[model samples]
Target: MTYSGAVTVGGPAEVHELADLMISKAAVGPMNNNAYLLRCRTTDEQLLIDAANEPRTLLALIGDDGIKSVVTTHRHGDHWQALAEVVEATGATTYAGRHDAEGIPVPTDVLVDDGDTIKVGRVELTVRHLVGHTPGSIALIYDDPHGHPHVFTGDCLFPGGPGRTTRPEHFESLMSGLEAKVFVLPDETWIYPGHGNDTTLGAERPHLGEWHERGW
Candidate 1:
């Protein structure tokens, strides 16, 4: 089946296969958080993005292969509800944004910043810090040599608009970051968000101005 990127709590995950990577996306927790498991095809090395919730479900998806690292996109409780448990079970190194590391109860083995590179086998992901939804919200980018770029945006972005922000300044900051960093990519870039369905930059690029005007 084609990957639609739509998932529900308790539902089976959707898998998207690339030339060198296999991505499995599962929705967990009452908040319906999306957790992504990325595995390298060449080396079988794996990395997980957002432990989210439902430790059993996450572990089941992980199976016995285990992961090398678990990256928390932000400090939000919903995003890392199962962080400690998952890390304990898998013994994976924990990574989180530098500014928000202190907010997470679990110790961060690696404090990542914008432009940092994280490796899963031979595949490398560039970290993009998008502030607004959280002080240290980040998105991971995988530039496929044979295809379009893929981005795992935490709560920083969604299909309809940017993630929720409490203040006008925050909204502006998020908009600026998206334009300067994310939107600059080609329109074919696929966006896998922290929640809900996926979208392409082309589909959302037209609405950037509208999102800013609405101030969400």
Candidate 2:
């Protein structure tokens, strides 16, 4: 399957080839939340991100791949609507940001913290705790051996601006995390968000100043 192709019943809506790993994406539910399945080519181990919605659809995408773990980006309802069902079906270990773990439906087996490394087969993903979108919002970074970083930025960072924040303090937290953990990375970094299309750090970096001015 070609990269960036949609993964549906017949195929993946979006497919990304990263070194030894492949990422498949599908948008589900009324919220149009993006659910991602990451597979390790060498080990055949799979890690699923945000079981969003539609248990049947997710299970179909997962097929017999055998999900090793399910990682929830945040406690948002839209992001984990099918978590309980997915876990029951797959018996996969559940992980969530330590601060938001309590809020998610299924009890998180592991509470991830910033700077922690999440193992997917032999691959290692660095975790970054991004606040504002949610106190426990977190993003995972995978440095592909081929170059370019692949980051899954839950609801914290998106294409046009940061995730929705109701207060100035929340916005500040989001901006600070972006500046420190996200924007500081190379422009080639590929971003996979919770919903909609994919974007690169290079494509969004130039507009950071504009985003700040708009106060979104």
Q: Which of the numbered candidates is closest to the native, going by highest TM-score?
A: 1
- Write the residue-wise lDDT of candidate 2 on 1-216 in tens digits: 566533343334577777799888888868878898999988989999999988888998888877999999999899988999999989999989999998897999999999998888988899999989899999999988878889999998888989999888899889999999988889999889987778899989999899788888
For candidate 1, the lDDT comes to 0.94
After superposing candidate 2 on the true structure, give the runs of residues whose Cα lies further than 4 Å from its correct spot: 5-12
Query: What pairs collide in candidate 1?
Result: none
Task: Please state the error at residue 133 of candidate 1 in Å.
Answer: 1.0
Candidate 2: the clashing residue pairs are 5-13, 6-12, 6-13, 6-14, 7-11, 7-12, 7-13, 7-14, 8-11
How close is every model to the real structure, measured as TM-score? Answer: 0.99, 0.95
Q: CA lDDT of 85 in candidate 1? A: 93
Among these predictions, the greatest lDDT belongs to 1
How far off is residue 167 in model 2, in Å?
A: 0.3
TM-score of 2: 0.95
Q: Rate the local accuracy (lDDT) of all candidates.
A: 0.94, 0.88
